[model samples]
Structures are given as structure tokens and as C-alpha cells.
Target: MTEKEKMLAGLPYQAWDDELVILRENAKLLCHQFNHLAPNETAKRHTILSNLLNIKGQFHIEANFFCDYGENIYVGDNFYSNHNLVILDVCQVSFGNNVMLGPNVMIATASHPLDPVARRATEFGKPISIGNDVWIGGNVSVLAGVSIGDNSVIGAGSVVTKDITGNGVYAGNPCKFIKSI
Candidate 1:
């Protein structure tokens, strides 16, 4: 059987790396489109905010929200979410002050398996947190086990998979701290 099939069968597996890579690629594609899509507004803000989902703070959407299960998400003051924002929030996703999310940005708190025999279908999640004054560029994906520090700037098309402590600029897959901001 294929590795994906084995994982989906719900067998025991250690699945942090393999799932993370696939998830990053998928999320990157989604965010890429989200960043470029135009907002559907007639008179006022035609933002996408689902009632069946949970959202905090005075929501200001300069775009659309394709959120999946919005129960575990929170936004802080002066928050600005640009077009094509998708959040797969299975666990807590907290964003701090003056957080600016560019187009097609996604914050996902989900995971799967690594072992080919145990990677097909199993799923899990971790928490994500963005500190104050964080500016995330368009097409950025913040993965499950990530916590960005205050005053950090995530460049466009970057994928963050680990905790960022110092304030700085980060970009690329498996986002690395580029420079102090």
C-alpha cells in the first residue's frame, strides 16, 4: 500500500515533517490566489464573514475570508485583513495589535502524518499566535506549530512552520528570520 493510504488508514505514525510539507504547498497555492482576487463589494464592505464561525475584535476585512471552522480564531485591535484570507483554525489562532494581513494569507493550525504507512488520512492540530505589530505579506502561510514575535514582518509567499522569537523579517518556505525589523 502507498504511504498516503497507510496514513489515512489510521495506523500509528510519527507525522510532523511529511504532512507539514504537503500542507505548506497546498496552503501556498490557496493563498496565492487569495492575494490576487478582487473583493466583491457593491456599496460597502462585501467581506466574507461566516455566521457559523467564531471571530473576535472589530472585524475589518479589506477582502474575503474563506475560513474553515472559525471557532478557534481571534483578532486584535487595528487589524486589517486583505483580500483572500483563509484560515483553517482547528486550534487557537491569535493575532495581536496592528496586524496587517496581505492578500491570500492563510494561518493554518492543522497537521497530519509522516510515515508513509500512517500518512494518508490522520489529522491533528496545533496553536498559532502572532504578536503585536506583525505585518504578514500577501500569500503567506503560517503553519500549525508557529508563534511569531512582536513587530515581525513575514514577506510574501513565505511559509512559517516554527516559532519566531525575535522581531524581524522572514521569508521563504520554512521561513527564516531575514533581518531585524
Candidate 2:
């Protein structure tokens, strides 16, 4: 399989492969263009995002947004993200409808091997799935392979390292359930 195929399949792959590098470069260029546009240039921004991401419906993301591979990021309807959002979507990063992300939220699907020798030679990633109507507060970091269920609220400054069931408020590092909502 190709490096991109291996990456998408959650298998170890060389991240420095030529095809992967070109894809990342293209994404970065598009992100740069999107981020540098005038605040009032809504139409232009929309056009750029449409070309970059797999947005299912209406969505709005503030400036300073960055991603590893735009094609690997899929956002559902009514998605909104505040400024400085970074998504390292080496694998699929899927967001359900009506998902809102506060400022400085980083969702990473990329990971390195634990073994030092293998880590330097290859990288791996797992997909992240966020259910519908989820609200992630500011400065939250959702790690690789996490699935957050629908109607969940993640409090500010949390680091989520595990799957979160729906209809609850979760907070703190290694985010724990606070109370059912």
C-alpha cells in the first residue's frame, strides 16, 4: 500500500514520503491563504475552506486554523470553531453536526511509536470521532483515537485522552466525567 493508504489505515508509515509531503504542503498553502484573508472576506474564506476540507454543510472557522492533511478532516453541518484551532489529521478526524470548538482547541490524530528507533522511521495515527452537539471549551486538546459522544460538554483547559460517553460534562486533565447533563 501507499504511504497515504497506510496512514489512513492507521498503520505505520514513513511521514516524509514525497506524496505525503506534497499533500501537507498543499494543505499548508491553503491554510495560509485562508488565515491571511481579510476578516470581512467571508466569501473568499468560504471558497478556500470548501476547496480544502470535506465539509458536509455550513461551517465557520475563525482565522489561524491549521491542519496536517485537509482531506482527512471531515466536519458536519453547523460546525463552528474559534480562532487558533489546530487539527493534526494524519488520519480521519470526523466531527458530527452542530459541534462547536472554543479558541485554541487542538485535535490531534497523529502519534509516534513508543520505540525510539521505530519512532524516528515511521509515524502512525488513529481516527477521532466527535458526536453531534458537542461543545469543547477553550484550550482543550483531544488526543488520538478518542470518541466523544453526542451532547457532551468538555470544560476549558482539559486534555482528553479517552472516549467520553454522551450527555455529560467532563473536565480536567485526562478528562473525567463531572455530571450528567
Candidate 3:
């Protein structure tokens, strides 16, 4: 299978493969262009994002947004992400409509093998999915293979390690449900 196919399938693959490297380079270039635009260049910024990610409908993403393989990330309508948002989209990372992410939030789909020998040779990835009407607080880290259910709120400085299936407020490191929202 191709490197991209391996990545999407959550199988081990060389991240530095020529094809993957090229895709990352192109995404970096587009992100650079989007990040350096004038404040008034809204139309151009949208155009750049149009070329970079699968952004559907409307979104107001702040500057300094970083991602790997932007094409693997998808954002639905009415999305708003604060500054310094990073998405490591080695696999697919999808955010549903009305999703909002606070500053310094990271959604990472990339993962390294625990085996030292295997880690150097190949990397794998898992998908991250955020349901509609979700709000992820500042400094939160959403790890690989996680899904936050609809209308849930992730408190600031939290690290999400597992899937949250029910709607509620979650907080703390390795975030746990605080209370139902």
C-alpha cells in the first residue's frame, strides 16, 4: 500500500517517504501564505484555506494554525479556532459544524510506536473526530483515535486520552468527565 494509504489505515509507514514529504511541504507553504496575510485579506485567506484543507462552509480560524498534511483535516461549517491551534493530521481529523477550539489547542492524529526499534522505522496514525457544537478549551490536547461527543466541553489544560462518548464537561490531565452539560 502507498504511504498515505498506510497512514490512513493506521498501519506502520515511513513518514519521510517522498510522496508524504512533498505533501507536507506543500501544506507548509500554503500555511505560511495564510499566516502571513494582511488582516484585511479575508478573501485571500479563505482562498488559501480552500486550497489547503477540506474546510466546508464558514470558518474564522486565527493565525498560527499549524497542521501536517492539511488535506487530511476537515472542518465543517461555523467553525472557529483561536490562535496557536495545531492539528497533526497524519490521518484524518474531522471537526463537525459549530465546533470551537480555544487558543493553544492541539488535535493530534500522529503516533509513534512504543518499541524503540520499530519507532525509528515506521509511524502510525489514528483519526480524531469532534462532533458538532463542541467546545475545546485552551491548552487542551486531544490525542490520537479520540472522539468527543456532540455538545461536550473540554476544560482548559486538559489532555484527552480516550474517547468521550456522552455529552458533558471534561477537565484535568487525561481528562475525565466533570459533570453533564
Q: Quote each prediction's TM-score.
A: 0.69, 0.99, 0.98
* CA lDDT scores, all candidates in order: 0.69, 0.97, 0.92
TM-score of 2: 0.99
- Report the Cα lDDT for residue 77, model 1: 72
Q: What are the clashing pairs of model 2?
A: none
| Residue 68, candidate 1: alpha-carbon lDDT | 42
Error of 1 at 132 (Å): 0.9
Best candidate, lDDT-wise?
A: 2
Task: Tell me model 2's lDDT, rounded to 2 decimals.
Answer: 0.97
Query: Over the stretch 34-116, how does candidate 1's per-residue lDDT look in tens digits?
Result: 43455554223322342323445565665456654444567777788887788876567888878899999988876666776
Which window of 10 residues has the lowest lDDT sum in candidate 3?
Answer: 164-173
RMSD vs true structure, all candidates: 8.0, 0.5, 0.8
User: Candidate 3: where is the Cα deviation over 4 Å?
Assistant: none
Error of 2 at 68 (Å): 0.6
- For residues 22-55, what per-residue lDDT tens digits would candidate 2 score against the true structure? 9999999999999999999999999999999999
